[model samples]
Target: MRNAHRVEQVRAAEAELMARLPEGALMQRAAAGLAATCARLLTRRRGRVYGSRVVVLAGSGDNGGDALYAGAVLARRGARVSAVLLAPERAHAGGLAALRAAHGQVVLDQEVGLADFSRADLVLDGIVGIGGRGGLRAEAVPYARAARRGTVVAVDVPSGVDADTGEVAGVALRADVTVCFGTYKPGLLIDPGAGYAGAVQLVGIGLDLPPADVSALQHPAVAELLPEPGAESDKYRRGVVGVAAGSATYPGAALLAVAGALHGGAGAVRYVGTAAEEVVRRFPETLVTEGGPAGAGRVQAWVVGPGGGEGARQALAEALASDVPVLVDADGLTELGRLGPGALAGRTAPTLLTPHTGEAARLLAGADGGAPPPADELAAARLATARRLAAAYRATVLLKGSTTVVADPGGAARVNPTGTSWLATAGSGDVLAGLAGSLLAAGLPVLDAASVAAYLHGLAGRHAASTPGAPVTALQVAAALPAVWRQVRASATADE
Candidate 1:
């Protein structure tokens, strides 16, 4: 797991480092890494280092100090360095002095102006860091917005992005690459901010931080959660997943669900829905049941309501009552409020509720339930939303969106790191639900199953989209699962 400490936690860690280190040590370390990254990016773009124009958007905090120090390095390397101070009066004095000592030019924002921005080879966004709140203040906004496709590097978190919640309260500077110091912030992992973060490179400052107050899982965490097919394990021993989804109105939902479940390592898939014929036509392997989920013999888990038909309430209630775990999605989620808190509160079997924001808002705003909190910006509000749902419905809540957040009953959450915008196509959510249901059948806990499934689904979507205009159809995403599994399952050392 990659620890994404909250802003307060990062401050405490910085304080700890400051107490032990000599003056100027931490700043120098940060600046050195920043300068080195800029040099590489310059070399990659222009092929020559000396003549490049480097602009620093300086702020009042140590963040601007970091830029000034880095500017001094670039100046020493023969790259022309200029500083445009957003907070001219309060800019880090020591850093300004050092840059001047290294032959760096200081220019007011109005003096150099936005026209100079186009000619600049690179821009170092030192306008804000973890200490920043809201967007770039009134002055910094225009320059940040003008820097399109420029090789922009954020000092820590991007200027204007909320480090704690991944919320973009105001216009944010989008970074081509972000060189993070000490530790990763939650914003760098969650969406809106995550998307703005671009590619991230961590520069160790030797801060011995404890476990994150919040965190996001990387590849290794995904590997640990994946089930390995054993030599002694038969098909039956692996798991059998039952999917009760799709209706005459939405046959595509059933097909996508079956497609995803097939690649989820399920030994078999049993279908119980109005779309039975569609499942049989798409996949001969799916065993169609004439009755309902309970009449489908034995199943380790049930995936309910991709696109439910008539009398979905009774079928869903029956699935919930089964001794096995239950995954509720789509229509099932909308009606979950009817389970009325009492049913969920009393249920013994583990339950997973997958609801998007619109569904969540309705479910959360019960008449006796109180007004719903403002919908979170994205996954930033996900942890809070999931916690609320888990507490209210008494089930593990997987809030699906740009960044899928899987929160356990205890409020511990994992923000998915692998999802893509290309997954916005139709029937993708059904495929995701089926994939998660299969993991539950294979004996993983709700949080693990939902998170791992999301990771796989995202990777598969990316892999499929590699084909031009491929669009990553639901079947394409499912087919790419084996490749995703292989890439993650490679038994390489961490260094590799």
Candidate 2:
């Protein structure tokens, strides 16, 4: 797992580490890592660092000092380096002296800074640190709009991005690479701010920290969480997932959901809905039944909704009434929103709610009895949105979007790192819902089920859209799951 700490946690850890070290030891370690990464990037871009043009955008804090000191190292290596101070008077005095000693050019004029920023082979952005909020200062706004010819490396978190929430309220500078000190920031892992951060590289300054509230699962961590059958396992023992979805108006939803469940590590799938005939015709292996979830024989878990149409409300209620875990999605989420959080109050089993921002708005409004907030606003602050929904509903929530975030009511969260834009196609979410529900049937906790399903679903989407990169259908994404599953397991075993 890749852990991400909030801004306050990072600050506390940094301060404690600094106190134990020499006056400048910690900064030197950070600068050395920054300079090394810059050197590698420069070597890859051209042949060498010699004669390359490097520009440093320095602010008034330690962030700027880190950049200036790194620039001094590059200058000694024969790069033609220049420093543009956004706050000249408050700039780090030691960093300024070091850069000047290395014969680096210092420009205080904004026009000259803009000119250098546009054409430099590499630009180091230090205009604002993790503590800075809102957006870039007025003096630094031009750099955000300037045409650039090379890679821009942000000192830590990207300027103007919320290190704690990943919220970008105003204009923020985009970076090709961000070298964060200590641990990863939540802003660098979640979207909006994540989109601005091209590629992230972590440089540890060796700080002891507590458990992280946010994390992203890597391949190994996911591999360990996957459910595998034992020697004595039978079909029933492995677990059966019950899917209550679809209607006369949208029978395809049932087919797509079952397709995902079949390969989701569950031994069997028992489907009950109005689309039973269509599901049997497509996936004959599915155990189909008539009517609603209440009549569906035995199932370890229930996946309700997904093109349920008029039958969604009944299906959602029946699934919640069951003693097993339930996952609600699509039309089912709409029903849950109408009924509010109280709908799940009587249930003892675990519940997972998967909603895109639009549905999320409805769920929030349902909880508070107000007009739905704009989808864009909720999406901009995905971390908080997911946590809020989880708390309000008292269930695990998987907020699906540019970055899939899974949060429990207790505030522990995980962000999925795998996925492509192609996963945004129709019925993709239905497939995800079924896969996650199947995992729940197989006995993974709500959080693990949602996170693992997201990981595999994302990989499957990437595979379906690979090579020629043509548009793929929802079934193609489902078909790609088995291969990706094998790939994930194989890669994990090889690493061992």
**Largest lDDT belongs to which candidate?**
2
Can you write out model 2's per-residue Cα lDDT over 1-496, one digit (the tens) per residue?
8999987898898889889999988888999999999999999999899999999999998999999999999999999999999999999888889999999999999999999999999999988888888988899989999999989999998898888888999989999999999999999999999998889999988979899999999999888988899999987888899999888888899899999999899999999988888889899999988879999889999999999999999999989999999999999999999999999998889999999999999999999999999999999999999999999999999999999999999999999999999988989999999999899999999999999999999999999999657788899999999999988889899999
Per-candidate Cα lDDT values, in order, are 0.83, 0.94
**Per-prediction TM-score to the true structure, in the order listed:** 0.92, 0.99
Q: Worst ten-residue run, lDDT, model 1?
A: 372-381
Q: In model 2, which runs have C-alpha deviations exceeding 4 angstroms?
A: none
Note each model's CA RMSD in angstroms.
2.5, 0.9
- Candidate 2, position 207, lDDT: 79
Task: Please report the TM-score between candidate 2 and the true structure.
Answer: 0.99
